[model samples]
Target chain A: MVAPDYLQVLVLAAVAIALIIVTIEVVARIVRPHAPNPNKYETYECGERTIGSTGVKIGVQYYLYALVFIIFDVEAVMLFPWAVSFKEFDGVLGLGTIIFAEVFMFVGILLIGLVYAWKRGVLEWQEM
Target chain B: MVDLMNWAGIYDTIEGFLSGLGLSFIIPLTLYAIAALILFGFVAALVLVTTYLERKILSDIQVRLGPMETGGRRFHGILQPVADGIKLLQKEDIMPKNRDKLPYYLAPLVVFVPVFVIMGLIPLGFIPLDIASLNKNLLVAADLDIGILAILALAVIPTLGAVMAGWSSRNKFTTLAMLRSVAQGISYEIPFVLAALAVVLAAGSMNLSEIVKAQSGLWFIFLMPIGFIVFFMAALAEIHRIPFDVDEAENELVSGVIVEYSGMRFAFFYLAAYAELFIAAALITILFLGGWAGPVLPGVMWFFIKCFVIIYVIIWMRGTLPRVRIDQMLAVGWKVMLPLALLNLLITSSILML
Candidate 1:
């Protein structure tokens, strides 16, 4: 019963996806027009001749948003197992109140972080 | 009243038939191979049809006719996607000079494979089909115990491809798009997972088919309307549709991460996007709309109908709403959707306890 059926399905589907992608690409290579001039191969930037470097300084706002997201994302992941396992304590007296209070306390701490971010205006897109 | 597609029974029969033909050793391999092909074909065909439908629906919503020239005036250019696909296949495959070749090439496949794989796990509900004399129809390819988690895990992977595409393109526009995608992916995923966790909590199982079964009496939408709404909004973000399409703002980014890709490589990204659209709707259907649950139609038909209805809603959103800024997108994901999902979960837990 513990067989890796899901893994097998995944592998099989991966192979199929690969096969389809390859077949389409290879056929396109054979039959499609192949005309690659220097201009055609140039990175598309509104058809203007390339200028400036690709790696430029990005706004710190994006980074800040990502930081807040990562924090919340981790918290969400932890919450899932706890939520699922709530059934294990289904019959215990005061299970509902105990679990609710504990989970909310965990959420409340994260909410504090969120509130800090909000107050700092890091949640604003144009903050940078 | 319970009609099922009976894919499991059909697989057993096929295995038996293969054994009778004295090819028992290859049965497992053959069965999986066929299933894979079926799933691939299903996704490809559905994507093609939906692309056309989106065009036509959008045109109709805007009071115009769409694609009346393709497919010889019959079916309103239903074959336009096929024609467009052939045209794309025949177009020049351009590789931007001075770009990172390996990641550039691998990005589309990375984005596409997982999305394609997800289709096999979506249960279309049981239909009472008399095709192979099989009962107990399980419409999905595999009903893994961790179906919801498997989907959540795989859906998280496509952002890697977008980032790869952006970085490999060696362009500032793609880089900006990649940044937006990463932020969008991270921010939206939390709410998406939380909303889904609410459903999982209510259903008491992560298996999607079981979730559907739990909904037979009352769909989760009725019980957890806020979660359903959050799920829908986060889903739109996951697929990078309008209002959440900051990653690929056409007016600003040209084409975003796929800006440098051409030909079939470009088509892979296009295909994956449509596949994501379908899967998002299918997930909603299964989780909230009660997969294939309706009064009159067959389960499979009901499933697709519900999916298309959601698809229509999404298309309507694309047609109507202006794109939100990146920060605004994150704000909604973090500030609005996430907390609502948590509250919905807490409410659901309290209700279940009572």
Candidate 2:
């Protein structure tokens, strides 16, 4: 119940260090051909050879999808669990239900925003 | 737990160390082993069944008959996993030519281990088991103080494996898919973590049980609507399913990071994908649904029902919604979500402080 005691932290840190060493060792062993092909090292994040200049940048439509993702993602995680617990804590006190209802209202507002975005074509797929 | 750890001598060394570790540790370790084995066998079966059900349900939504080809007896497709196991067993495993054999071989294990560990953090169902005539808490393996952190920390590995798998394959499609996966993972993870942070703030403990307990009066979702929305979306993205699955976009990336994998190696990725889905789903249940908190049914049933329902939603959407563009996906993470998450955290903190 207390924050993992010092010993636990030390053990965890040790595990982390071991994992790092293991990673380095694995990488060293795996990179076989000693020839430094200047192109090979630049893969993905390491900026390897141009992988067709990545994907073309789309406009606000991309932003909108991510926004909606955030919106719906939060909705699913929070509300479903709340629904389960609300049924449990229910017993004459209308307070929890009222709070839950208020959340539904918030979701209602977001839906309105979504509809607005939909109408404004914010979520529409556009050619970049 | 210390006693449990003393019992945790490496399995390879078990035979030699058996008499040396003393019977005191042996007795408890034996009990722990039995309990763990039972738990594993049960969950493994559940994973298989849950997978079959997801496939069946998703197929039904798409108006396709699923697993009918396998059963040969009027949708008796429950035997599918058995058939799959046999086929995987019979097939020869192949390593990609340019792959790192060690981590490449380790990818599946890395993918699964995180999932197995996170199971402990979730308050699915606990059984009371006797060890050395002691009533030990048999529900979970080890319930850490930072329970949610334990889950999140372990959850990050599968994406790395996908990246490693892609890189090792030396395939263009996989590398592209993995790049998208990395972006998806990092983006979704930020919101998920922030959302968890919000819940932890409200609950005042990382222990999932304690968080569930905090909601005895009210669930955090009611107080923090934005938080719930952000969290669930992030969870969906984390699993790389349906709407957020541009990483594996079949038409675009052509099987993406897993294009080159086949046979049992592919099965490992498939199993890992489903496992990741449940692990994330279970976390959502624990964090927001009130871990094991429900009326009429026992906590585990309610927990599972809620989980299947969410999983069903993912399956449903897969057949319903068209995949979103990748950059748009990132935009959602940064432009909209990051801001909303910050606001939700701010509001929740202010409320708790007051």
Candidate 3:
């Protein structure tokens, strides 16, 4: 089956953007000066000679935050369908309250997780 | 309601004209080409105007004349952004030694493409003149069902590009900057989505145009002021604007994940930033400010008027506020904004139920 009109337009738009980027880059590559020097290739270090490896270990605190973010992000995703259909449910008897309560329990559990992270100092940024 | 000029009617007229010439087979292609051109031109113009406006506004705030030399003295450097674009196009492209060649080359494209795609999802304005046509919006490329969700989902891709740029650069500062940006981006995003969810709950639709239509009687800003504030603050952080721009703290990280890029690649990052800024402002206009809704003026005109006002406020904040510390930024996102967004959601849902 053929894709819907909007999807077709979206794909066409994406292609057009890719074409624009390519054309611009190609023109720039042709017109721009090309002189490569060793000094220019070196990483910028604010005038000081670079020392040590670039892959320095960061605080594990970031990873912990990422973990928490994943949980909340999922919660947000799950909440969208309910949020959209809420009006329909509200028009029906008894169903609106049930759906609202279910979402409340779901979000409440996630909020508890967030609070747990907060209490555990997982949200705190530890300076390295 | 006053009858506004209908883009959909014009589109159908064009399609019929083409069909009369026995060009019906190429109609879709032609329409798509036209849509792409209009969208690109609009976004490019927005970037140019906003860049110049930003400099002029910041300069005025600092009691200085900005961009008086470009274009002509009479135009007050109106052509400054154009000059900058041409200069960047002709600048030398630099690649650092021992960098990850693939991602280094691909990073800018990754950062840019999603922003362009998100532009397609925005309903610029509405004209109810074409009752027969599928879309009534002025010039939206795709009025998708999951409009806001698609926008939010696509918005996350650029952060990946930032991380890739930082990691591939083989530079300490870039890595640190990307990490900070990732932390900040993810932190702000929760409240942003939650705040937007409050709007969705109130409007009872995920489609952006419908959300705008829902605000016909009363704008969501009046109904949920806390949600608007939370969304706006979270949006500022998401775009890495000043006061929430710790990642690109020039005095510290030396231009953040983009430190090593030069020429057109560097230009891509700036273009993406401006495009995202426009999207944020437009989203605020659509979600909270009764998009395209006003007396007398056409919907498209009103939509843009609201957008520019919001954009001006953003620029004013940039001129006024200092960058918050990274810790403070995260604390605001998580501790303050997140709870407030949740509370807003709770209140909105309860009110709707009642």
What global local distance difference test value does model 3 have?
0.86
Instruction: Point out the higher-scoring one by DockQ: 1 or 3.
Output: 3
Decoy 2 TM-score against native:
0.69
TM-score of each: 0.92, 0.69, 0.93
Stretches of candidate 3 exceeding 4 Å from the true structure: B1-27, B127-137
Ordering by TM-score: 3, 1, 2
TM-score for the A chain of candidate 2: 0.55
**How big is the positional error of residue A87 in model 1, measured in Å on the Cα after superposition?**
4.0
- Evaluate model 3 with DockQ and give the value: 0.65
**TM-score of chain B alone in model 3:** 0.92
lDDT of 1 at B225: 96
TM-score of 1: 0.92
Task: Report how large a share of the reference interface contacts model 3 reproduces.
Answer: 0.64
Off by over 4 Å in 2: A1-128, B1-36, B69-75, B126-138
Instruction: Please provide, for model 3 over B1-354, each residue's C-alpha lDDT reduced to its tens digit, 9 standing for 90 to 100.
Output: 001123336557767899899988866666666666667777788899999999999999999999898889998999999999999899998889989999998888888888888887888886545565343434477777788988999899999999999999999899989999999999999999999999999998888989998999999999999999999999999999998999999899989999999888898888889999999999999999998999998888998899889889999999999889999888888899989999999999898888
Predictions' DockQ, in order: 0.59, 0.05, 0.65
Winner by TM-score between candidate 2 and candidate 1: 1
In CAPRI terms, model 1 is classed as medium
lDDT of 1 by residue, B116-149 (tens): 7788778877755655655446777777788898
